[model samples]
Target: MKQIALDIGLTPEPTLAGFLAGRNAEAVQHVRLWAESATRSPVPSYVWGPEGTGKTHLLRAARQALQSQGRVVGWLDTDTPLRTPFDERWDAVLLDDVHRYGPEHQHMAFNWFVNAVSPLHGKPRAVLAAGRLPPADLPVRDDLRTRLGWGHVFELHPLAEGDMRAVLRQSADARGVFLSDEVMGFVLGRFSRDLGSLMQLLDKLDRYALQTQRAITIPLIKSMLENE
Candidate 1:
C-alpha cells in the first residue's frame, strides 16, 4: 500500500464520527492525550495493542489532529523504506507496523527513533503503532527496544459483544447500508469474532448486495454466507 500523508487541515471529523458510532470512549481519550503529548514531548510514544484493535485508525487520527495544528507530520510504514531522516525538518513522525521491519531496517529505525527523541537542535516527536509491546522476543536491537519503551504505551482492548455490535453498526452506517440486528447476530454466531473478519465480511456483503440489487436481510446474508 502507498504511504499517504494526511491533510493537516482536515478536522479528523470522520474518525471522530466512527469513534462515537463505535462507542470507543477509551480510544477517543487516548487520541486526545496523544495529541497533547505530541505537542510537548521530545521523545516519541508507542501505542501497542493486539491485531484488529483499531491501532491503525487511531494513528491516522492522531496524524490528522497533529497536522491540523500546522505541525509537519510524516508517516512511515515499517514495511516500507524509512527514507526520511530525523532532522530539524519534521515536527512529528508516525510509524506504523514497526515490528515488521527487517533487521537492518529495524536498526535504522532505532537510530532514527533515538535521533528524533534526542535533545538536539532539531529533533522530532514520534508515535508508533505495533501489534505488541516492544522488546518481547522480536528481532529488534536492545537499545531500540528500550527507547520504544520510553513513552506512553496504551493497549487497545478487544471490543466486547456490545461494542462489537456498535462497531458493525457504525461500519454499516459509514457505508450507507443498514445491517439489521438479526443479520448481525447471524454473522456473529457463525463468523470469527475478530474485527478484521467482520469488516471484510461487511465489505463483501455490501458489494454483493449492490451487485445483486438486494437488501441485506438475514435471508440474503444467509444465502451469501452459504455461497461463500
Candidate 2:
C-alpha cells in the first residue's frame, strides 16, 4: 500500500535573520541589502555552493524581503517550468536551484538576468539565482552561464562545527526545552550535521519529549532513534 503522509506543522519562514551565516556572512548581507532596496544598483547576483549550504534559504528570504515593501517580485524554482519570464515589471527576481533546471528554464532565467541589467529598463532591478556549482562550471548553456557572472557572485561555504552547535542550542532554547551539553554532544555525534536538518531533528525531539513526558536527554534520543 502507498503511504499517505500528512503535514501537521506550520512551515517556518526562511529569513536572513534566522540564518546562521557563519563564513557566508558577506553573501547573506549582499542579498539582504539588494532585496531591501528598490532603487539600489541593478546588479544581478548569482550564488552557488554545495547542496546544503543555505542557497534556497537565501533566495526565499530575498524574495520575502522585497515583497514586504510592496515591490513586485518573481520567484521560480527547478521543480516547475516557468510560466512567465521575470522581467522589468518586477523589482527583483529570485531563481533557485538552477542546476536542476533543464534548457527551457534557463531560457527564462537568462532573459531575466539580461533585461534586469539592460540600460533600457530605466529602473533598478535585481536578479538573484543559485546553483550547486560556480558559474564557469555550471552545466547550462554558455550564454546563460556567462550572464550569471554579470553582478555579485558568491560561493557559499559550509558552516563551522561551533556555529552548528550554537544553532541547535538556540533553537532548543526557543522551543522551551533544555538542551543539555551531553545530549547535544550525543546528537552531534549520532545525527545529521547540516544546520537545516539538525534543526528539524531538534523539532522532532521536542515533540517526542512532549509526547512521552520526558526530558530531551541522550537516553531519550537514543530510544527515539532506535525506533526509526
Candidate 3:
C-alpha cells in the first residue's frame, strides 16, 4: 500500500497522556465505557461535539487504549489527503476532524471506508471524530455521509465549572505550579467558558511564570491577563 503524506504541518499530534491529564472525570468515564463496548463489537465509533469540548481527547485516549492491547491502529484526517496506507491487519482506525474534509477529499474518504469495511484478509476497526453529527450534515458526499453514521456515536458535552476548575488545577500542577482556588476562580470568571480559551490563558500564564520565575498566584495571573 502506498502511504500518502497528509500535510498536517506543525500541528501537535494528539497524546493520550496530555489529554487524560487535562480531561474531566465525566469525559474519562464516558471514553472508558465506550472502549469497553468497542472491544466487544469492534465496530466503527463516532464522537462529535462543539469545539473545545474534548472530542479529540476522547478519540486519542481510545486510540491509546486499543493500541496498548496490541491492536493495529491507523489515523486519517478527513480534511487532508489519505497520506497513510490502510493496514488490512489493523485492529482499529481513527479519523479526526472529519468536517474539514470537503467534497474532493470525500471521494478519497469514501474509498478508504470501502477498503476499511471490506471483508478482506484482516480489516481494521474504525473510529471517527467530527464537529457535527451525520456526515450528510457536513459538506461531504452523500454515500460517505451515510457510511459515517453506520456506527456507534458519542457526543462529548462541555465541561462544567467544577470540571473546568479541576482541569485548570491539574494543568497547573503538571507544570509544577501551584494555582490557588482564588486564582482559579478569578481566571475562570473572566475567561470564556471554553476549554480551548482556558488552555490558551494557561499557556500564557505558564510562559509568564517561567519568565518571571514566580508561582502562579492571583496577582500574577491578573497582571498577565491585563497585559495581554
CA lDDT of every candidate: 0.67, 0.77, 0.66
- Work out the TM-score per prediction: 0.76, 0.80, 0.73
The parts of candidate 2 lying over 4 Å away from their true place are 1-10, 82-89, 119-124, 173-178, 203-215
* Residue-pair clashes, model 1: 0
Ranking by TM-score: 2, 1, 3
Is 1 or 3 the stronger prediction by lDDT? 1
- Model 3 local distance difference test score: 0.66
Collision pairs in model 2:
none
What does candidate 2's lDDT look like per residue over 53-150, in tens digits?
Answer: 88887888777777778888778777755657555567777778888878888887777767676746476567789999988888888998887877
Task: State which candidate has the highest lDDT.
Answer: 2
Question: Pairing residues by index, what is the TM-score of model 1?
Answer: 0.76
**Between candidates 1 and 3, the TM-score winner:** 1
Give the runs in model 1 whose Cα sits over 4 Å from its true position.
Answer: 1-17, 20-28, 36-38, 82-88, 134-137, 222-228
Please tell me which predicted candidate would have the highest TM-score against the true structure: 2
Error of 3 at 61 (Å): 1.6
